[model samples]
Target: MSTPKKPTEAKAKPGEGVSRRGFIRDVGLGTGAVGVALSPTAALCAPPALAGPGPVPVTLTVNGKQHKLELEPRVTLLDALRNYLDYTGAKRVCDRGTCGACTVLLDGKAVYACNILAIEAQGKNIQTVEGLALSPEPDPLIRAFVNNDGLQCGFCTPGFVMAAKAFLAENPNPTLDQIKRAFGGNLCRCGSYNGIRRAILEAAKSAQGGGKNA
Candidate 1:
């Protein structure tokens, strides 16, 4: 009987199983694939000399002052105020639009500064908590807040002040229920709702007497 032949496995050499032409084509295709994958972020770290999105010139009028700022298009009005212009009266709580801590008056209407783009506020009059007390004496709204104890930590006070200021402007005289409804958008973590309502009511009284115009 002939000696049994041992089974041997065949090892593939470099490019042995594939045609040389196919191997070269696949390598080229792979390089192209890698280039495509990296193309999106290739320009991200490019030097400023390279053509890419750059800072944009934006003008924002705040508290009766015109401010020229160079900011990225993605910057929010809140960031421009607090970060750039040093207007920290609008507390930087709840960077999102939800908390109402960044409330401000845009053209006399209450808006969340965090939701508004700085560029979009061009030509519109903006009012912040700092504007509320421009004179030597504190405004009635501010006084009401102090007297009524509407603030605990005071983080949300500026927003409440601006919101109340806007609401009182539209409705100089509002009932307690109306005050509650008007401030529905604002949330006080300190649970000072009763004091806030009282402050608004007292401010309304002052407005009724024509003590100070908001």
Candidate 2:
């Protein structure tokens, strides 16, 4: 019988074998499996990659107090207030700069605290709802909110108070329509808009008439 032909090994085409995408996918799966298989002690012994940029020293002035903090630059003023400083009056809702729940006065203007970085608020007068009632006697604005039944769940109350404080400070005698427009940026999920407006107007009137009916 004739000798069997020598078996030939097939060569992969130049562009064949695992594609770049397939290689990446396989490597990723393999790496994940390897990680999963590793003991906790072994995993701990491995150097970890950085999770984010290093924290930086930042100083913020809030409600007339100077606060020094070490934080990542990405931290927002709302976080700095509620998280670091324990000033929880500004609620962290609608964090995308839409809802005014985190509203505060930056240099006497209403601004969304969530929209501003803590670094950006440095050296500026940052007024939060907490500062609005800092006096020994309750502020007339607070009195107005309570007297007018301006809130229900009260989650949105602090922000509404700050917005009204800023609005009345600018326009101490704002009309009903003006009060509504002034608070347009803020939202009350409790549907207490009319009561909020009334509170603002009453606060405005009290501000103008020296707080007798606030």
* Cα lDDT listed for each candidate: 0.77, 0.74
Cα error, residue 206 of model 2, in Å, equals 1.0
Question: Candidate 2 deviates by what RMSD?
Answer: 19.5
Q: Itemize residue pairs with steric clashes in candidate 2.
A: none
RMSD of each: 20.9, 19.5
Where does candidate 1 stray beyond 4 Å? Answer: 1-52, 210-214
72 Cα displacement, candidate 2 (Å)? 0.3
lDDT of 1: 0.77
- The C-alpha TM-scores of every prediction are 0.74, 0.73
Expressed as tens digits, the lDDT of each residue in 1-214 for candidate 2 is 1111221111101112456886677657655655654669656665664221235567777778887776655568887777677788899877888778999999999999989887778899999988877789888889989998999999889888888888877887777877767777888899998888888888778768854334
**Which candidate comes out best when scored by lDDT?**
1
